[model samples]
Target: MATSVLSKSVLPKVPKTARKTSTKTAALQAQPDAHEPDANKTLNLILSRLDDMKAEETVTIDLRGKSAYSDYMIITSGRANRHVGAIAENVTKGLKESGVKSVHVEGLPNCDWVLIDSGDVIVHVFRPEVREFYNLERLWTQNPAVAAV
Candidate 1:
């Protein structure tokens, strides 16, 4: 006789372990949020996650009239390559958990700079030297026409 296809041995077992929230995240949740409007909920979530990860020199640019792609662009520097990757991953995870779908990400393997694009926001995580070399904030904030290029 042939073995049963629906046998218990053929099925994968799943563990029922309880999940614990991280101390950092719990602490952040306890703090009162400086209320931004409903339109900026996603933006606030990303910013908080970046803060939790210790991302530095964070700059937020209002791209409301400037770019059709997203309403906001956030540029932040991580201490190093690993930090950049971690920051990007954290932001992406947060976006997904917040029910934002179709988030796009790039540059994770290189880790010198990582870009996360949600529909409403774009985030750049870079190493200090890499951020200085690109100077993306200057392009976007200083000259609108130049940023288009």
Candidate 2:
């Protein structure tokens, strides 16, 4: 003889009032500023993380007026590839835990130079040789007059 099996029942409908309030709450939370920390706060958080990770030659270049991409560009060096990767990983994790919604990372595999873009702040973690070769601080902080002419 074949046995009959019963499926689970459907969920009860949500009350309209409950649904409306939840939808409104979600909409309010979806606003960009509602969740984003202040740009300066985020920058400081990143800097502190880099320091804690023992990143060397840390330099912060103001990119507010110069670049539309980010408000600040931070360049720092690590003793080696492993150190570079660790610095990048630590900074990325720190930013996320500190309420940063999104963090983008690149060049982590080789660890020659790792770049982390955390909304308002952009951080570069590079091996000493890589940092010297790129010289990002000089490039970004150069005098506009000198660069133009």
Candidate 2 CA-lDDT value: 0.84
Models 1 onward score TM values of: 0.72, 0.76
Clashing pairs in 1: none
lDDT of 2 at 70: 85
Instruction: Give the residue spans of candidate 2 off by over 4 A.
Output: 1-30, 143-149
Per-residue lDDT of model 2, residues 52-121, tens digit only: 9999999988877777778888999999999999999999998888888889999999999999998799
Q: In candidate 1, what are the lDDT values of residues 1-149, reduced to their tens digit? A: 24666666786765544256778878998985444223399899999999999999999998888887789999999998988999999999988887786789999999998989887899999999989999998889889787665
C-alpha lDDT of residue 29 in model 2: 76
- TM-score of model number 1: 0.72
Clashing pairs in 2: none
In candidate 1, where is summed lDDT lowest over 10 consecutive residues? 31-40
